[model samples]
Target: MARIPTAELSRYLFAGQIGHRGCLRASRIRIAPTSSSLQTRQFASHVESQAPTATTVPPTPLRKQLKEQAKALKASGQKKKKKVDNQTVPGWELTVGIEIHAQLNTARKLFSPAANSFNDDPNSHVALFDVAMPGSQPVFQPETLIPAVRAALALNCEIQRVSRFDRKHYFHWDQPSGYQITQYYEPFAKDGKLELLARDGIAAEDGESITVGIKQVQMEQDTAKTTAQPGEVQWLDFNRVGVPLIEIITLPEIHHPATAAAFVRKVQVMLNAVDACVSGMEAGGLRADVNVSVRRTDDKCGTLGTRTEIKNLSSFKAVEDAIIAERDRQIAVLESGGVVEGETRGWAIGSTETRRLRGKEGEVDYRYMPDPDLGPVVIDLPLVQYLASSSGLAPDAETDQLIEDYGLTAKDAISLMALDDGARVQYFYNVLDALEQKLGSASVDTIAVDRGLSTLAANWCLHELGKLTELSNNLGMTHKGECKVPSADLAALLYHLHRKEITAKVAKELLWAIFRGEISQGGVTEAIEANDLWFHELSEKEYSDLADQVVEGEDKVLGEFLRFAEGKGKAYPQGKLMFLVGKVMRAGPEQRMDPASVERVVRARIDEVYIPGLKSKE
Candidate 1:
């Protein structure tokens, strides 16, 4: 048989299955006849006669391939060729860095007795030390150091034994101290890395991992918050003045905005796992400052373009959008043969854009100095180890175990854990253990516990407890330790539902009444009995009576049902069947038969009366 040219083979493959035009024109290439020796000989002779002779010098590897392909196409000149764009946009690359601020889970401020809580009255949580009064001395809280150390360890960083706090001086209405205490010369932790997984897009891998290096994780105090001014002066809230915070600085190693957003989300999950920070992006508990730069493929990391710092990006969406905008801005500048200026910029969340805050020349020095009053923080290694090993396994690990052990999807496990801010996971496990003992099971696993307990906990906590807490907060209700609806009662209510002593609807109503303080322990069962909320057990006679009413009362619905039974209907009688069941139940209001039983009875009666010949179908 005639040898197929390699170029022809590649063209066959490419044209057959590659591009849009290639795929469309693929049917034109016919397989050479291989049946008879005579046919093969003729084909071979024809191919050789058309082939080039040795007098023409052979082409180079790349040139030979191109020439062969061009010759093949020349033979088929009647075919129209599509043009492809090979024009490259020169000097375009994205560089990214991250500045993460994690709110320390501390009881007090880094240098004051001010309570580190959000949503408190303005300035109510502030102390004299927070205001930086002349005589006020800076005293570091031990609780503050623990979480900072924990965060550093979680990031896989080496914690410094002797890290000093410096004065990051800047003039702002919120800063009563005139300077913020932070680590500059010597940071608390260094040399850590994080892995992020992109969620979507063509460039995105469903779980494609990217690792970013952590330059430092330093302990700092948060500045006071400023409320936007409508008329004149911006209202300053000093309550957050001295709140302890950890700043996780990442190297400018990221190349894509999507990857950076993914990294931030993973970090947020990690923080929540360790209970180091609340993942409240809007409330400023976990905030990010994106540092973006651009360069060519050949440019060195730092030599690319000037890095622009996008400040106080609160959400993952904001981080990704701001980085994209910044990347495009830098790319545009570079394409125009202009240099991008190094500056700090503020992201407008509403418009999803960035505006320059200050140029490099206008940068604050933030004079560095150690706090004279506060001494060195000496970390006890044993205590650190104990905290890591015994405090409880990370939530991520538990979530993974739940998925593997229970055959649950990752989304389900994540959803279950995220319910009630992660309290549901713990409560589900606890309740499951109690239930297993009650049921006399020998060591039930996480999967069984998840499947068995997830629904109950979700309803009780997410729906019931959430509603109660929200109502209490809204009404400014105070609990004197004797308020209605204790945790045990909530557990008992779930238990009752599991035992089939109460229906799901009745349980919800009971929970609401209990939460509202309308039902107390003395009237618990009485309230249920008075409301006639118990799950009713239907007798055979009652079931038969309801079935008869459903068959006789609605002639149109009965006709549709008969058609479905006789296999003469194009569509199922679902709506009419439901209406028939409803009519039957409406006739006997005191009969509390569930919709399931009603459907079962109606279907059975329809089959017996209308489809006696269809008995073999079932």
Candidate 2:
């Protein structure tokens, strides 16, 4: 050959190494001379020799070889085995753990007396210690410890009598101090557990509960918020610089995305119950950092693959979707013959995939050292004992109480608690109490079940009143946590509706009238009678006459009745009979008759008239 092109020579060398193992085996490859130069010829001769064959075939190109290898590998065993439990992809098992940073709701910062508040003017709440002034000293506040202990107790954590803070060293624009003050060596609380109930819709298995392990709950100081602008200008908000936080680290026990989301929700409910921290995530009160990883079915149970941390998930939905998207991403990486590096990642708003933020930092990288300024935190024994016994009831306990006391189903109890921080649940009890007092009964079971009041009250409070925006605002804690409709007033409406004195249609309209000042306290009965909203008692003769008028006016409905009476009925014709019943109710003023009574009367009239007409024709 006169001259060989560089591209073609490289292609031959690449394709010559392709082997049955689906990879390039460079040691077994042998090259042939493409140029007559002595240097090239000598190099070619030094390569391993191939045995002679009767017939030779041309080598396949590298691109085609790679595609064939990938396809063959996938078809052979890449997807042959499936995971037994909690499989997001067919052959892969996903693992997830979360780090929740919740800002404590306190009047002052953790170490300093600076006011702990948000959305105020920037720099207004900062103390000299918060800004890391040279001579400023840190003073530990006893008030901050109250909420932290309460939060730990709510999570069923074992509180450490002696815990100390350490300095986590890192250089960032937001941290005015050279280091971050946190608890790394010895945290405040450890070995906590949270149970995800099946009825809450986040259980890993259907109709079963999952218990997630909490590794530690450490107290830390939050860093200042940093906003980066164009041209390298950095803006810092120091309002959040020294806000108190509890870093709740969970063990790698969660597997499914829904379970992770549910776990966070349960934490929020717990914190709220104890008045520990600000539970809302949108206001930067709570944030989640999720660590996600994946492995194949053959791997050992404890042998977890490389994991990536997705940071600053602001909402429960974001926490759920981010884990799902990140887990799928890792599986795809391993399937393509690539290794997933440990890294920190960020999920941009509205984006499904996570982007790399930085390499994962280790403890050595953080250079953790005990803070010289702060001493070991001491907990009072009496206070701890008091909290253990008197901590606010969690949502689970409340759910159980609601079920046993009110005879409400688990679903109904959960729905009531979901409404605005359990305020609706409080209102629900108020209505029941008011009804009990009015009916002169002390037994919840008797009051709720004997008169059908439990289901009736739940329907009005959650289904009807909960749906109206104006009513929800005005009636739901608008007056210092008091219902505007006055639980007693709504109870009166339920009382009348239960006794069949007014139809449900009248009850709803009268409820709105109450909200508009048209109905006042003790005026439910007066208003119903005055407006003719009450159902009037009618004799059998009057009902029959009314039904006859409705049946004669609707010719088409009468025809269907005739068909049914003549034994040519295709179906039960119940709907057609109900239509005529509706006509009879409309014939009365305000349609005050009960629907069941209307249907009964209409059925009798069709039997008396339509059936007789069919007999005459026969």
Candidate 3:
């Protein structure tokens, strides 16, 4: 909350920062549209992901030992959680501040005309300005500010009417400009806070709360990348130089690794929701650095513990793992009567422990000064509102409204917003709006939850469409532009589903078909007519015969029903009934068949055939 002068702030960033980029950025930023910000991974189905593929090295014995220790510490922390988290780890209290660097989603670099692309040939996208060539002067990229403002608003920060930029001097191969330009003093936004609605890696129980302080949101240029392999010369790639990055620095309010990791994931999600970044941490478009320190449980206001900064965690899991490992390591040092040293450490992807990168220095290490090359950034309230309105960002306070309106849980809305995939969220609501136009407002509400429309849409995007895109190796559902399925097509498909013109299966098939280009423009009707992928009503006689054929054909369900009829088997029947019902519908003559009709026929046939036959036998 306290503002340091430009010079002092510059010094502070340099002193506390890791070499090259103030910190080595993490591996990737994965953005998912879900209930909680980055609470769930849209990329991986689950929250836990293995380290990025690039850093999957074999762990040394020491690494294994450290990992085991981390597990032990984490388990102990879980056990100790009763009242205060400060006492959760037992014998030591761990506190953390997370720094997330989200690479802005843009076509051009922050201060260069070069294209900002992932997976292109290395250095091919680099401009002369990127490498800081003598004659190449840095230029402002207007595109960067939109996402930055969106992010600040999402974090509940006050936008500075005018923000200044300063340069922090540091030397590294990746930093071609010996002094890196940053907002060490005046950032675009400051003094904000966000509540991570998670406790222990899942949604906090209903009626629970946790808040992390937002120190500032600084719009800075990402440093160049360096590839170092032991025993070989290090490679410097300026391809990443001058890439626009937003640094979300949090207050040291997180007391546990799970909470810290959740907050980072939340930021990743929010960044995506605001259309600020693509949110793929594995791709290095986003990454996190965690600062960890341990203190005595009784030393509430005592001097802070010696902080060890972990640099470049590739994934959320890695962040948690590194925190746990470092937490235990620091606690052990103190328990053994040794002082915890302040240093910068790097997380080895395959290992359980952190490697000491360098001794942590003070701000004096990087002398801060105003950059003569770049002028101040003037951000007005209108600009902030325009960005927020254009991006369709939901207010951070509207979690409850989102849940009630969409029939989603608080976590679900938070996940959706956190990924900052506002477009997807808007598209989903537009589907609801389309349904409301037909089914009425109340009808739409019933459909979203009771009928599973909300879950269905999320699944179709997460699993089915995700699979299709992944197979094609596209960016998947995260990026609105790159996703193969048009929002209109998805909405139309859902509309057909709501009207009961198509079963869920039929709807999915239609979506895939359309996305695969098997069907061209137009809505559900056109898609259905084009591909013969509709579900229609079956005649009573035809449906009955189909149901009879399925029951007789599948002995498993037939036997189970007979056993169930005799009251020998318990009540829940898993497959036979639905399986028979599905078989009748799919094998029906009508391309567009009514599924409810199939269920009705299947039940009627069971009563006429199975019940009478069983009674006669008795």
Highest TM-score scorer: 2
Give lDDT per model, in order: 0.64, 0.75, 0.67
**Candidate 1 lDDT, 160-262, residue by residue in tens:** 7777777777765466656778887688788998765332111242246667899999988888776543232233455677888899999987776667776
lDDT of 2: 0.75
Q: Name the lDDT value of residue 191 in candidate 3.
A: 93
What 10-residue stretch in candidate 1 is worst by lDDT?
80-89
True lDDT of residue 111, candidate 1: 85
Is 2 or 3 the stronger prediction by lDDT?
2
TM-scores of all candidate predictions against the true structure? 0.66, 0.71, 0.68
- Candidates in descending lDDT order: 2, 3, 1
For candidate 2, list the clashing residue pairs, or say none. none
For the record, the alpha-carbon RMSD of candidate 2 to the native fold, in angstroms, is 19.6
RMSD of 3: 11.4
Cα lDDT, model 3, residue 139 = 86
How many pairs collide in each candidate, listed in order?
1, 0, 38
